[model samples]
Target: MAKTIFITGASKGFGRIWAEAFLKRGDRVVATARNTETLKDLVKQYGSTVLALALDVNDRAQCFAAIKKAKEHFGTIDVVINNAGYGLFGSIEETSEKEARDQIETNVFGLLWVTQAALPVMRAQGHGHIVQISSVLGMVTLPVLGLYNASKWAVEGLSETLAAEVKDFGIKVSLVEPNGFSTDWAGPSSLHTQPLDAYNKVKSDFQAGLTDDIFGIPEATTDAILKLVDSANPPLRLFLGKMALPWVTQVYSDRLATWGEWKEVAEKAHGK
Candidate 1:
């Protein structure tokens, strides 16, 4: 059965690919970006099947308005992909409070608001899917990507809790944890790097390590997302790309080993 799908950040990157994939599979797509002009070509190509809306997920009013517009156009939104986000790369100490807060606003609160706006419609319909575009950083924290990791970690927790809350209503929540994908995500749109004299020695090495050349293609993530959307029973968390699998596995194993080593002290501190 063809369904109506609404995706955020569909101007480019994984979101764009996801929108196109769904369209190819005969689904109606309500794709949105802050600037709808970027999607003019997509609108021209797909015509009535693709409804392009201008939205900034960070704006609560716009979030609700966008959902309303999508629903008005498609009747119902079968899936909602929260893929509008960016990264902030800098040491925790070097990153200002404003930058950290903005990261949370865009990556965490933005999704929260959009999900909240969509929940009522899904509940009324008694069925829907919410897909969160998280990252491997959600599972493991790297040195300079603290704010980005924190935002994704919040999404992981939120998605888990939401899954339990909405499952009874036939609504499913999923997190897409993709490893570095070749997207403009790491380009000029990325948050400006904050430098501090105290960390100068290690900053260069860290900057080099964070470059985008190491990422794989964005299509890997889009493929995983399509599979999840089409599955009769999709996973709560879908890890994308060959790199994401091993990296996530290793992070979980290492965290488990470290936790086991500290279990005794941790339990005692918790009064267990």
Candidate 2:
């Protein structure tokens, strides 16, 4: 059965890929971007199947209004892909307070606003899926993009809690954690803080070690997304990419080791 998919940041990147995939499979798409004009090609290609809406996710009113329009246009949103976010690239100390706040507002709060706006409609309909486009950074830490990591980590926590809260309401939630995909997330879409000389060595080493092969193919990621969406028992968190599993596995193993290594001390601190 063809479904109605509501995707944010559908102008480009993974969001656009997902929109194309769903449309190709005969689904209706309510695509949104800050500049709705960017979505014209989708409307041209898919015709009435696509409804491009103007949305600046950071603005609460715009978020709610866009969702309202989506509901009005499509009757109900079957699945929502919150894929609108930019990375903040810089060391923790180098990133200004303003930069950090702006990153959180767009990446975290924006997602929340859209979800909040969609929930009522979903609840009324009694079935929906909310997909959050988080990153591998959400589970594991990265050096230069700590702020970006923090934002995704927030998404992870929120989605996890939300999944439990909404299960009884026939609403499903999933966090798609992609290992670095071949996107402009670290390039044009990123906000770079003024370089701090103190962290030159760390920055240089991290940048030098980067490789294109680390990125997963976008098409493969989209295929995985389609599979997840079709699943009656979708995972609370699904990691994409070859490195995603290994890296996330390491994060857990390290955490478990740390906990076991410090078990006595941990229990003492808890007054157990």
TM-score of each: 0.94, 0.98
Q: Candidate 2: what lDDT?
A: 0.92
Q: Which ten residues in a row have the lowest lDDT in candidate 1?
A: 205-214
lDDT of 2 by residue, 89-170 (tens): 8899999999999999999999999999989989999999999999889999889999999999999999999999999999
**lDDT tens digits, residue span 32-139, model 1:** 999999999888988899999999998999999999999988899899999999989788888898998999999999999999999999999999999999998898
lDDT of each: 0.89, 0.92
User: Pairing residues by index, what is the TM-score of model 1?
Assistant: 0.94
Which candidate leads the pack in lDDT?
2
- Model 2 residue runs over 4 Å out of place are none
Clashes of each: 0, 0
Task: Rate residue 101 of model 1 by lDDT.
Answer: 90
